[model samples]
Structure formats: structure tokens, C-alpha cells
Target: MSEQHSGRRRRPHYRALSPLREHLRESFWFAPLVACVGAVLLAGLTDLIDREIFAEATAEQTADTLLSFASAAKSVVSTVSSAMLTFIGVVFSISLVSLQMAAGQMSPRVLRLYVRSRLTKATFSTCLATFVFALLVQLGYDETTDPTRAVSVPIVSTVVALALVLLSLALFVLYVQATLRLLRVPHVIDRVTRESMQVLTAYRWLAPPPGQEAAERPEDPPDGPAPQGPVLLHEGRAGVLRDVNIRRLVRVARRHGTVLHLVPRIGDFIAPGTPTVLAAGGTAPRPRRIAFALNVGVDRTMHQDLSFGFRQLVDIAIRALSPAVNDPTTAVQAVDRIHQLLAVLAPLPVGELRHRDRDGAVRLVQSVPGWEATVDLAFTEIRICGAGQPQVTRRLTAALDDLLRITPQPRLPPLLTQRRLLERAVDAAVPDEHNRAFALAPDRQGIG
Candidate 1:
């Protein structure tokens, strides 16, 4: 039997909606656009309700009472409509400042956190919708010359507008609170760690457990020697390879009687004319079809890139340790989170990169960073940058020691290697033996 027919499929392989969904999630406009449309429709409905029910009902009430109600409601709606514009301006102004501070103080990549915030989107959308709803309600106010004429006071619209105004006020408070919390280093670090943890969970599911990996591995060349076919070059704009349509690639390869090997890993930058896909075996698949199976975007997203999370955390740590910042405590805090993420990743079988169809033939092969590469990406920059800071070095040493205890024997070398390099760095950077010894000591809290 062919290798394709040999092993059991470990996880479900399906096309992801990451391209469209990720774009929409990260965009600041889509949510508000959807809310405004809904608000407009709601405003129209309230106007119809008022014209049909309140217009006739007002005829039965005294003229004095009707006039008073209409005047008061119109006053309220007008105030809310005008004030909502100011509210939007203030909210977004503060948001922009927060983004600027986060970019300068932390990593520019963390700006995505603010943009992708649901509270930020909700607050802006609610303020916008409230303004639209109140403005339309203000227009629905009807005037008449004669006492006998029925007045189509916007009673329903006024009530709905008031409710929207209250919602806006509530969301504004929540947004401000959230924004304040996000500005603090600990909160920001925790949020990034949580997101990375989610990505780690997804990765664990995609890759099989350690013992099962070899048994579940698919045959690479099928029957004969490895065949190499046409290479598909990247076309169009340069971008980071964000995701792969693995299922689609597998289907295409299976149909063509070929094995499709993706040239770039997730998070790799792809320029036009770069080799994207390599076909081997039977007939060559269409280059356009193969390219469509990949999602390349301007920025690296956490959707499928494992290293992106590590990249973000490391960026924050190094930025904090920079001389301009001189914030060693912040760097130590970031290292704490990094240690947590590494703990979660230490034991997993994270190397699986082959995709096979139902028959068990390897249809797609992609490259992924292995354990050593991940360890280096996580530690090398921080180890060098934070070498002089005793707090950061101590914290890093503590983390490495903890990881060494839990990591399998096979994975121990990378952690050991990082430890050796860290010691050399500390010895060279710190001239004083007492400070060097202090930095060498493993302190999980970095001296607390």
C-alpha cells in the first residue's frame, strides 16, 4: 500500500476563513459601518411607529399636554444628537493617543490590540449610531398651525434615541476604563500572553502528540523517488505569508496526482517572483490555483503564525530594556509571560507540517520552525539586550531553569544552550563579580 493509505488522519483539515475574517476583525471601520446601517433601519422603524400610533393618540390628548410633550422630547433628542458628535471626537482622540503611546513605549505591532478591541469598536459604533438615530429623530418632529390638525410627534423615535444615548454613555465609560487598563504594562503583557496561549492551543491540536507522531507520519515520496516539477513564483504585492489553505492545497495536489510543497512558512515575507510552491510527482497544478491557497498580507497576524506571538512578547521585553526606556521591571514582567508561554510549549509535538488527503498520501509539505529555532527566537534577543539588567537576567535564568526541569530529555539541549550563552553574556557585561553572581542566580520574581 502507498504511504497515503497507511496512517490515520490526526486532525481535521479544512479551509480557513482567516483572510476575510482577519481583515474585518483588524479594521476599525467594518463594525461601525454595520452598526450605522442597523441604526438607520431602526430609526426608520421608530419613525413609522410614531407616525402611525402617536399621531392618532395625540389627537385624544389635550393640546397643552401634547405641545409640552413634543417640545420636551425634541429638546432631549436635539441635545443627544449634538452631544454624540463631540463624544465620538473625544473617544477617538483618546484612542489615537493611546495607540501612539503604545507604539512608542512598547511595540508598534501591539497597536493591533487597540484596533481589534471590541470595546473600542463598540464605543465608537454606539456613539455613531446614537448620533444618526438622534439626528433622524430630530427631523421627524412635525409642526402644525391649527389645533384641530393631528400632530405626528416622534414619541417612539424620541424614546429610542434616548435609549441609544444611554447606551453610548455606558459604553464610553467602559471604553475609557479598558483603555486605561490597556496602557499599563502588566495588563498589556497579560493580554498578549492570553492571545498567544490561544494560538498555542490551536497548534497543539494541529500537531499530534509526541508518541503518536511517528506512527501518524505520512510517506513523503509515495512509491518511487521524489519527483520535482514546476515551481510557482509569487505574483503581485509583497506580504507576510499569514495562512495556508491546507485543505485546498491537498485537494489540488490529490487531483493533479502531485505533491504540493509550500516554499515559505507562515510569517515569512514573500516578495514578487519568490518561489511559493513546488510541485512534484505527476502533472503540474495551475500556478494561480496554487497561489490562491495562500494568504499573504501586509502584516503578520497570529492566525497561523506561532512565532508571531513570541515576536510580540520579545519585542515588548527588548523595548522595555532599551536604554531610552530604562524600564527593567517591565522587561522582567514580559519575561514572566514568556516563561509561561514556553512552559505551555515545552512538551508538545509541534513539528507536524505534512498534509494528506483521505487516501493517506502526503499531498502538502510545508516548513515550520523546530524546537531549537523557537528557543532561539524566544531567548537570544532578550538574553543579549537584557544582559546588564540584573533583574531581567535573574528572571531569564529562573525561567530557563524551570523549563529545563519540565522539558523532555531530547529538548533539554536548546534550553541548556541558551543557559550557556546567557552566562557568557552576563560574565562579559557585568565587570563586578558580586553583581554577576547575583545576575546568575535564578530568581523567578527577579529579586522579589
Candidate 2:
């Protein structure tokens, strides 16, 4: 009973925080909002310093000099205050337009790239901060009509505002450059591929050893017969299953001496009534506790969903292949990055990973994509959309053949299956025999 009470005390804080963290990460307003608040506080501090410390200047001559400096500073701060509001408006407008263009040209999923960009957030934050700081500094200026009288001049505040404006100007230029670069297909593909690779690198350890289960021993069942415990249903608003607190779930399972099986995979959508987990071989855990161990959100993320990367790449390729676009070259570029990701994933273990407690009981079972699913995800759509385009077809052929050569023997069948499908697609789509042959031939550069 004590153990049960202690287990109940373990709140699912990770589940709650993960989604919030992801939301903040993808929001454009949060950073700039923070910057504005910080600017206000900083301006107040500067004003305090100017009044308390700088107001004590010794001589009338010194006061006159300070008054002249304050007058010039007031003009500069006023100018910055008026200009920065317009500057932020124009800069952000360009940014939004650029994002819209990129989304239309590529995939909506790529919008996260813009949202998560440090440079982008930094640019916006700095500009907004500068604007707010300038306004505060201008308001802190002395209001006395008499020009000759010694008044409190917010000298420090003015200097800080000018520095912020300069910084904002520099960031604006870099933001423009980055936004333009982001519109290019190759750069977008590369960025997605790089993020996916990082996710893959982090995920690799959970994979089973080659041709073996990721468990304590072969006898340990990765997933046993379903437990008779009550099913845990999702109670939250509908969302894409983003991630899971597997360790926490395992702890819960271990405390109850049972196995917890996740019903929805990482990328699956879970509605309010959807089955989220099954507690087997022990007493059923509380539905709320189980639900709190899962992270759900508005869209899929790279956190634990490796296939999202492939999905994004395929979206880009097929969109480029659309008749309206008719840009096979861009499709080929997307395929190039897809092939690169596959090369990295090819030899790695691919299956569900089981987590065991210290006593070797299977506490958690995580469902992951197999090799075939991954290969099909990466190649199937591209092959279908790009079948008639010689550049795309040739590149697809080269990617499959290369994977066939480098991948482990067990992984060969999937690559072979994709290769055959590509061939069939090309055969069915390309009419001329010579053109078909050219499409079928493997060329890494896609006919270059």
C-alpha cells in the first residue's frame, strides 16, 4: 500500500511540459513578447541610474554640457522610436510573405523551420526590443519647457536605445538574407535532412541489435499476450501523438509489476476516446496518469517521429513534380537529400524497442517503423510522382541501387522491392523505349 501511494505521487510532469515546450519553440510571438518586457525593465533601470547617480553632477558648466547631450540624445531616441515601429512592420511583413511563399512552394511542415530558427526569432526579438526601449527612453526625457534649467536626462537610457537600434539594423539585414536563402529548395531540403539526421542519431540506441530483440534475453517476450487490465483511453483534446514519457511509464509499470503497451504510435492522431495504452499482467493504472505520460500536439514533430522527415521530403518532391510546378530539378534535389538520409539509416537496426526494469521484466514496449515501412515512405511517393521525369527517375534508380549495395543483407529486400517498384513505375509511365531505358539507368547526379 505504501508503494502504491508513492507511485501515485509521481506526477506526469514530463508529458505536460513537453508539449508546452514544443509550442513555445514553434511560436513567433513568445520571444518578441519577452524582449519587449525585458526592454521596459532595462529602460526603467537606466532611468533610475540617470536620476539617482547622474543628477548629482557638480558644476553649472557640467550641467550645461549634460543638457546639450540630453537634447541630442532625445532627438536620436525620438527618431529611433518612430522609425523602429515602421522597421518592424516592414521586416515582419517581408518575413511573413517569405514564409507564405515557402509554404506554398514546398510543404506546410517546413514552416516549423522558420519558426524554430534562432536567427529569425533573434531578429524579431531585437527589433521589437529596440522599438520598446526607444519609446521608453523618449518618455523618460525631461518635460520641462525651460531649456536652460538642469533637468534629469536619461543619458544611460538614450545610449542603450541607440545601441539596440544599431543591433536591430544589423539583424534586419541578416534576417533578409536568411529568409531569401530559406526560399531555395536545396537549402530547405538540407535543413530538414540535417534535423532528421540528428533525431536519427539520438534514436539509434533504442534499436535492437542486428537480427535480435532489444531485450534482456531472447526468452524475454517483447510483447506478451494482452493483459486483462482495463484499457486506458485518451481524455485530452484531439492531437497528433508527439512523444511519450517512456521511462515514466516504465516506472509506473514496474511499480505495478506489469507491462504497458502504447496503442497509438508516435505520429498517430489520438482523439478523446482513442485507446492510448494497455496495461497487461497487473492492476490497471489510472487512466489520467497513463494519459499524462503521452505528449500530443497540433502536428507531428521530429522529436521521436523519424518518418516525418521522409514525409516532408516526399511532399516537396511530389509538389515539385506537379504539373503546375513542372520542376523535376527541384524534385531531384529533394530526392538527393532523401537518399542521403536513407544511406545513414540503411544499416541501422529497425524495429520496436522494449524497455526492461532492473529485474529484466519488460516494462515498456515502443512501436517503431520497420525497414520496409521506412524504405517505402522514402521512395514510394517519389517513385510514383517522378516516374515519367527522367531526372527524378534516374536519381531514384541510383539511390535504390546504392542502398542495395551498402545496406546489410536483411535490409536488401526492401531496397530491392523499392527498386523493382521504381522500374515498374518507369515502365508504365515512360512510353519511348529509349527514354525508359535512360530513366531506368542509375545515375547519382540524375543524368548530369
Candidate 3:
């Protein structure tokens, strides 16, 4: 049976949305600005319609009653508008402080997580919308010198403004809860783990089923008598390679009748004039065309970089194990989560680095880290940093044991080597036989 037939049927692959759209979606300002505009319009419409209804009131009693409430409504809206402004300042200050604390205590990259948080966006939007609504309603109130021409108070708009105040209060409570959650170490670790898992899922390759002949992996075109000279594409600017338009690159290669070799992976940094790709074929695609297919950014993003997830978790673990922090339990938590992620990756064939065209011809050749690299990225640093900490060592040992049990035979050698290294570290760091035994034991929560 063919590899494709032996494995699960592939799902329909949809092209990712453009980078600009993704950025706007992840931005903190866009959604809140949208909410502010919507609130302004809604307040304006409500004021206009309510004012008209008051002007057209046929009953003298209703007109007099509404007129009596006009002054009070205006006063209420004015006060709420001032209060909402104060609230906005306070909320923004709190958010900034929370971000600072998170960056100082945890990984700075996690600040992006807080920035992209829906709860934070919703809270800010609600507060801003309330301020705008109250301000607009307050401005619409007109106390004319002539009684007959007096604008009837927009009772509906005022009431809605009051409701917004209440909603803002509720959102404040939620914001506090969310900030607390974000500050918690376990919550932060879990969030990073979930994000890393998502990246892993998106980038994982389907391996052929057991006993089925594996698919012939695509390799770079072999040197030939008429070998095309390698074309070196240089980077135009310095930044991290955040994403790559693989399908587009494949199309570009197929168009130029060439095999494009990408020099950098998703998380690599390339300075200007650095060799970025080596094109080998009849017609090399324009440098701009190749560059256009790559998305470079000031910092690494979770968009296509799987190692970034591990980098984040490892950062948290090492930070937790640091002398200033001295929180081995948190480190253990991070290792456990890393172990969970490794379990998911253990059986899969990682680092499938070839992109083929529609005609089954190799078009794009890119480098991807295999299982061993990923495992090393995930564990090696934590192991070295947390070597002296018994709790971290125990958790690391347990994690390796768990991985060794689930990982396929070909992937075992690395896990076994990691296990031995961990044991040696335990022996060296933990002198007491009892403590060493405890550290070597596969305890999920470490020694504790």
C-alpha cells in the first residue's frame, strides 16, 4: 500500500489568510476602536430618535414629566462621563502594571499573550465605549433660553449611559480576575503549552502506517552535467523569519522551473545581505519574489514557529529555577507540560522538510528540526539549569521516562540518552542515597 493510502486521509488544506489580516485580528487597538465607534453611533442615533419622540409628545402631562427629568438626566450623564474618564485612566494604568509584572517575573514574549488577550481587549473596549457613550449623551443635552425650544432630555440615551456605567463596573471586576489569573505561574504555563500544542498540530506531518512502505522523501536536485549555477538570495532587512508562504513558493519555483532552497527556518534571524535561499535550476525566481514569500518580523511569533513554543516554556522553567525566583514547583509544572507536548509529538514523523508542486515534483526545499532537536530544545536547558534542584530533576526524570514509554523505537535513543544524563545529574547534585532514589523515581509532580 502507498504511504498516502496507509495513513489517515489528509484534510482539505486551506490557505492561511494574509499577514495583514492576521495582524489586525491580533492587535489590541483595532477591536476596541471599533467598539468605541459603534458606541458613539449608537448613542447619537438613540439621542436623535429619543429627542424627536419627546418633541412630538402630544400629551401635556408626558411632556411636562419628561421636561422635569431633563435636568437630572443631563446631570447624571455629565457626572458619569467624568467618572468614566477616570476609570479609563485607572484601567489602563492597571493593565500596564500587570504587563510589567508579567514581563519581569515570566518571559517577556508572554507579554504578547496578554496583549492579544480577548478579556483585556473586551474590558478596555467596554470602558472606552462607556466613556464615549456618556460623553456623547452629555453633549447632546441642550437647555435653551426659550422654554418652547428646549430640547427634551434624551431619557433613553441617559438610561443607556447608566447601563454602560454598570457594565463598565462589571468589566472592571472581570479584568481584575483576569489579571490575577495571568499573574499565576501555573495559568501562564498552561497557556503557553496550549499555544505550543496548537503550533505542533498545525505543523505536524502524517507518517506512514506500520509495515507500509514509506513515501519517497524529496531531496535537492542532484548535481548534473548541466547543473544550473546556485543563485544566492540576500536578505533585504534584519528580522526573525516568522512565516513562509510555502504554497506560493512552490508556485514560484514551478513557474521558474527551479528548485528553491530556503536557508533559514521560521525562527531564524537574517541580517541584510545574508544568503537567504539557494536557487538551483534553469530560471531563478526574482529575489523580490522569494522575499515576498517570506514574512519577517521584529520578533518571533507563534504563526509557524513550533520551536518558539518550546522556547517560551523553557524560558518559564529556567526562570522559575533561577536563584532569585527559586520556585522548583513551578519548574516542575513546566516540565510536566513539556512532557505532555512531547508525548503528542513522540510517534509522529517530525521535520518533513520538502514541498512538492502539483505534478509531484520537488519545488521547495526547507530545513525543519527533527524530533531529537525538538526534544533537546524542550529539555536540555531545563535539565542544565535545574540540575541542583531535586524537585526539577525528579520531574525531568519522570518526564523522560514517560516520553521513553510512548515514543517509537527510532526516537528512543535520544530519550534514553536524556534519561542517563538526568540520572547522572541527579547522582552528582543529590548526594544522599535516599534523595537520589527519590529524584530517580518517576514521580509526576517531582519529589513533592
Best by TM-score: 1
Overall local distance difference test of candidate 1 = 0.82
Q: How close is candidate 1 to the true structure, as a TM-score?
A: 0.90
Instruction: Give one digit per residue, the lDDT tens place, for model 2 in 1-448.
Output: 0111222232222243555676688778899999999999998898888876455763333555566677788888889989999998998898889889998999898988998888899998998899888888877777663435645777888878878888988998898899999999899999999888976774455444454443332322236665466678998879999878766787899888778888788899899999988888877788888877787889988777888989999999999999999999899898888889888887665555566554545687766777788888888888888888999999988888888889877668878888888888988998889989988888888879
lDDT of 1 by residue, 1-448 (tens): 1123335435544435655777688789999999999989998898787766655555565554555578788899989988999989999899999999999999998899999999999999999999988988887677753445645677778888888888988998999999999899789888888888977776665564456565764312234454477888987578989887777788899899998888788999998899988888878887778778778788888766778888999999999988899998898888898889889888766654666677767888776677788899999999999999999999999999999999888789989999999999999999999989999999988888
Cα-based TM-score, every candidate:
0.90, 0.88, 0.86
Stretches of model 2 off by over 4 angstroms after superposition: 1-21, 58-61, 145-151, 208-228, 355-362
1-448: candidate 3 lDDT, tens digit per residue = 0113323454323265555555665578898899999998999789888878777762453676677778888889899989988998999999999999998888898888888788888888988998888888877777753446776568899888889888888988998998999999889988888888876665454343355424443122223453245766654678888878877888888898888878778899887777777788758778888888787878887766778888888998899888999988888888888898889877655665556665656677676677878888988989888888878887888888778778777778888888888888778888999988877777787875
Q: How many residue pairs clash (N, CA or C atoms closer than 3 angstroms) in each of the candidate models, in the order given?
A: 3, 0, 0
Report the candidate with higher TM-score, 2 versus 3.
2
Count backbone clashes in candidate 3.
0
- Angstrom error of the Cα, residue 398, model 3: value is 1.6
Rank the candidate models, highest lDDT first: 1, 2, 3
